[model samples]
Target: MRREFLFLSILVPGPDHPKISLDVFLQPLIYELQMLWEHGTEAYDVSCQQNFNMRAVLMWTISDFPAYGMLSGWTTHGRLSCPYCQDNTDAFQLRNGRKSCWFDCHRRFLPSDHPYRRSRTLFTKSKKVFDAPPPEIDGYTLLEQLRDFGANRTPDCGGNGHEHVYGAGEVHNRHKKSIFWDLPY
Candidate 1:
């Protein structure tokens, strides 16, 4: 199952759509699965140390799944409390002002100096930047960039006529909306 997950993870970068089948996406997909597996495993270790019961484990598991927020009951996504506050919040207000933005760790706090403060992606070339409408580089907006890169349904490198290669956001969109920064879903 994990192998399949890893396989698929490569096909779609979390903030994007899935382009290739198990072929082209195998590398990145494996990277994503291993990453997710490592993170979840690490969180499980943390919860164990914290002595959270099964309920806690279940909550943590649900929190790790980015799609979890799209469910009817869970709307909030801001970092509400210490450590796990954001992780624990089932409901988030997406349209709320930035002050009300939610995160997955609102339940508790990992020390200010926690080591795993961030997780990174393999694509160092194209970093994600948001806050305003997608930028227009060379007369092309970000959406246009995506379309140009073939991030849409047609796949096979999209309209750019280049071999389609989608990032995480593109692939994930096909299944469900990820509750990440600047997701339009």
Candidate 2:
């Protein structure tokens, strides 16, 4: 039993350090944004902001981590994706129905699974629904457009921060809209 459980851990990502709760990693990521706002105008802070300390929120995943070590299902970059589809899955899903992988990579990192434990409430309520023919919400597929736009570069290919209004780039990033992206026409 311990062996089996251990094996699974390698395939997922979650907080291993008891004191370092899953949410702890989010601090750097979040504060980085605040710092950017406070000092982004200066050329020095601009480069630091680009690194995005808060990016951990977007890069974390459970499959890539273990309770104390790894088991399997890791990528060359130490990332884990949906075993079935091989697509990167984030630790958190958007409330409206979007995956963290698509969201974070655009932010420029991956979602760590710790948030799911910390924000289990929001995570569960926003659970993604998948159907054979395909549910009205793909939740998982949102990354397709993100990759095309951000080129999967944290904050996505067209990294312009939150200003990336859907269809704002009608002539450029004309990614189709879904329940997740409610933009003004």
Candidate 3:
């Protein structure tokens, strides 16, 4: 609703970021959220002086780009950084910066008859975007994909001297199964 109403649920003491280990911290919160969503809790109304069932739902989360990656279990790096596009991303590495750039990647989302789709000078020079935008993936499909990546199967505690493989060829940007997916909704 408002910035003042937003409360910090968890805070990681920082010298280093939590990275993949963030999922461990989120497990408890996910459990509580599941309970609130399913069974809810009893509450008293002050003015009416009545007892009622209080339920809560998490609509979405707010975070910076890097933190979003951690929370969503998507790696916001490399050529396939956009979670929406996934493997269909049209990003390329910059020649000078040595970083991935998504320049002119959004043309496919425009209408087929849009003038910019046929313009050579507007976006990438001498290129026309006739391909359709990436297909939208659903939650169940995403969970199936994550099952292949072996995410959410075990605790993701760091410093175990074992390397955790991310994306694993099947998915380009997903690093792990997000804790939010555990919710039935």
Q: Give the better candidate number (1 or 3) by lDDT.
A: 3
CA lDDT, every model vs. true structure: 0.31, 0.31, 0.77
TM-scores for candidates 1 onward, in order? 0.17, 0.20, 0.81
lDDT of 3 by residue, 1-185 (tens): 56875875678787977776777777888888899999999988888999999987778888888999888877788887888888888888888989889999988989999999999998898999899998888987887777776655225434222246555433566766677777888
Clashing pairs in 3: none
lDDT of 3 at 51: 97
| lDDT for position 110 in model 2 | 20
In angstroms, the error of model 1 at 103 is 9.2
Task: Give candidate 3's error at residue 146 in angstroms.
Answer: 0.4
Best by lDDT: 3
lDDT of 1 by residue, 8-64 (tens): 121245765332222233334334444554443322346446642221111122323
- TM-score of model number 2: 0.20
Model 2, range 73-121, lDDT digits (tens) per residue? 1112222333222332333455685533333222212243344333424
Better of 1 and 2 by lDDT: 2
